[model samples]
Target chain A: MDMKINIAGVELDNPIIAASGTYGFGHEYNEFYDISEIGAISVKGLTKSPRAGNPPPRITETIGGILNSVGLQNPGVDAFIKEEIPFLRKHRCKIIANMAGNTFEDYCEMAEKLSAADVDMLEMNISCPNVKAGGAAFGTNPDTVLAITKAVRTYAKKPLIVKLSPNVADITETAKAAEAGGADALSLINTLTGMAIDINTRRPILANVVGGLSGPCVKPVALRMVYQVHQAVKLPIIGMGGISNGDDAVEFLLAGSTAISVGTANFTDPYACLKIRDGIKTYMEKHQIKTVRELTGGLIVESK
Target chain B: MSYQDYSCQICSQQEIAPNIIACCLENAHLAKNAKPGQFLHIQCGDPASMPLRRPISICDVNGDELTIIYEVKGRGTKALREQTGKVQVLGPLGNGFLVDNSLYKRPAVIGGGIGTYPLYLLTKQLTNASVYLGFRNQSVVTLEQEFCQVAEKVTITTDDGSYGVSGFAITQLEEDHKKEVFDIVYACGPKPMLRAVQAFAEKTGVPCQLSLEERMGCGIGACLTCNCETHEEGSAHYKHVCKNGPVFWSQEVVL
Candidate 1:
């Protein structure tokens, strides 16, 4: 079965892409398997300047997911181009530079810089809820999402994907706003804002107190948001939120995501993307599906 | 070095202490490749309840058998204790301890509580190594015999005078350092113990390697969750404990 799919104009070998923050520069996972086997890698969130991120105890486990307030720790965009881009260029898969900023200027500067670099696509990470500034603040509001997307769109030479925050009322509003702002495509939902507490210490587990939750637990919420956003916007969706296995990927496609990104699953299994790719193929064969694209929005909801 | 997810089977398991269990697995590749300070990212429980893998340090390796000693702390480890037969494991991950006996002779190996488990493998690989171990009390003291078999001398301390030397292990290490200066120091323990060891190593001007533990997400460099602060040329930067090291030089990290 054909597994290739396209996000915006960029073609992928398969529908599975490694989500940002989860897969750092694609160097670490390369040790487990050839990273080129996956369609694309959304490198860790990049900022204009190097961010040291939050203090220790930045991560904690919840019921079936994890809470992280990493606060976008990265080596800055310049370093990424000089140090990491070369390593990623050697690999065959497409590179999606996931850039985050505390301001619209930060996003535009990074977009202009990265678009001139070797990356295949630029993902505006306005949805990161861990930071104190411009991350989710710009993502949660429709006007701000449109404004940032429009600002970054002007500078980004490559296809731009606006990652959406899940901690908002009516995610479709932001989805429509991104489309309005000239986003080539949309990806959602970025981690849900949540917190965990220690009863004994009577303190929040994460040093940042609040963090974004991702894993199998958030799959349902992500799928619902993806389905809703797909209905609300004309742009293709890259569905993500706790997708672990093949069936989960299939669910997202049926929910109207053109392609899917694997996030927290990479933690549980290093070879998760490869396994998920194989799982998608297996699912396609079992169902006599020809192309993986046929599965997108294939859900047959009976009219009751 | 490349790492693979191996389907390993439990060879044998036994409870060495209250809430502490030592289990052995059959994985020839891991046993042969695993070095001191390297860890295994194990899928302990069902993903629905415990989604992330539990990172456990390598305790010992004998032929095709790899051993790990873990304390039942939370839901994940509790699920690990109940696991039987086949288990999926990704290892031997992160940079292992660099063993250069010619560079440094008379190594001082110090460990505290559950932190002492990973040091067992290091102690076994070293020559003329004096070990210092600290535990809560007698009931939790484990691998004492294991360390004794490998080390040139072993000193164990308990906080409440319930076992061996009644005091902190760092005190014993300091007291012993005066008599015969150790060429190199290696330590793994709780934060306070590690901090104290870091200070001692700095004050003595002896080269030291410390094995650290953090709440990790991916037991690889991919997830920036497990990070430790380090200073280089006066600038502090974050290093992933899973990648840059579970082990680092004494002067490398901030704490």
Candidate 2:
């Protein structure tokens, strides 16, 4: 099966990419299997400077997913380029540098610095829901989303994919705002804001009080947002939320995603990307689809 | 390393205590690679019902089979008890305990409640160590016979004096250490007990290693959710309990 997918001119061997914050630089998962077998690895969330992340109890399990408030813990952009990139370069997969910034300047600086680095693409994350300051704030407002996207676009030499947050009133408005800002492509939804509590202790389960919920629970909402954004914007979409298998990936593609990212599922099974890729291949071959492009926007809506 | 799931058939399952059960699985790779302080992430229940895998410690390892003892804590664990035929496990994860026989000839091992499960393998590796165990009361006390067989001397303590020595296990350990002047101390338990052990180890100038526990996601380093506070250079830093360690030197953690 032809599993190849192109997002804003960047060609991927397969359509299964490991989402940001879930797959660490690919070094850890590489211990289990050859990570290059997947389409690409969205490395851990990066920032202008190194972050220690949140306090203990950063994660809590829910019915069908997990809530995390890791607060973008990573060894700044420079360290990632120096220490993490060399390791990733050894692999044959595409490298999508997922970056987080506290301010506009921070985002611009990181984008400018990484433009000269050996990375395939830049995933601008203005929608991380865990941090208190700049993460979700810029993503929630249309003005800031456009401003940040346009500002980062000035220096981001590689293909820039703007990641959208799900904790918004209308996702299409934010999607259109990113399109207006000159984003090469888009990906969503970056964890819905949620909370879990410990009844015995009578306190919030996560130290941050609330966290971003991911896994199978958020798939329906993510699919709806992707379908809406595909209708609202012309930019190609890299859809992700609670995508667990090839069936879930196909749903995103049918809903109008150029490619799909496997997020929280990587935690449950490190080989989820490989399995999803194979699952897509099995589905396509069984359905007699010639190419993955044929599956994109394949959803048939019934008219009354 | 990459975490992969292995399906191992159940060798045996027995209830060691009121709510605790010891399950043995037959898997050669896990039996060979798993160490004293490391743990396994077991996928509990059917795929449709369970989202997260429960992390359980290696209670004992014999030949090609390993034992995991768990208490019924929540729905995740309660679901684990119903396993039959084969079970999927991802493991031997996190840095295991560092056991240097040359460093300490007379070692003291302390464990409280479920925390004792991880220390079992550590005790078996030592030549002549002293094992101190603490439980809520008589009904919850477990692995007494197992520890007795491994350690040169064993001390069991209960909070309400239902069995063994009364009072906290640390008190007994402190009282015994004065006469023995042990070279090394190892501990795993509740925060308060670990804190007390840390204080004693620091004051006595004895090196100690502790197996810390926390709520985790992706028993690998990627998720950075199982964080623990550690002090370095007059400031506090965070390390992932899943990767950086489930085991750390006594003074390395802030508790």
Interface C-alpha root-mean-square deviation, candidates in order: 2.0, 2.6
Question: How would you class the docking of model 1?
Answer: medium
TM-score of each: 0.97, 0.98
Give the per-residue lDDT of model 2 (tens digit) for A1-304: 7878888888889888899998888877897889888888898998888888888889888888889998888888889999988989888899999988889899899999899999999999988888854368899999989999999999999999999999999999989999999899998989999999899999999999999999898999999999999999999899998898889999999999989999888878778888898889889999999799888888999998
Prediction 1 TM-score vs. true = 0.97
Chain B, TM-score, each prediction? Answer: 0.97, 0.96
- Cα RMSD over interface residues, candidate 2: 2.6
* TM-score of predicted structure 2: 0.98
Per-residue C-alpha lDDT of model 1 across residues A114-161, encoded as one tens digit per residue: 999999999999888888553788999999998989889999999999
In terms of TM-score, the best-performing candidate is 2
lDDT of 2: 0.88
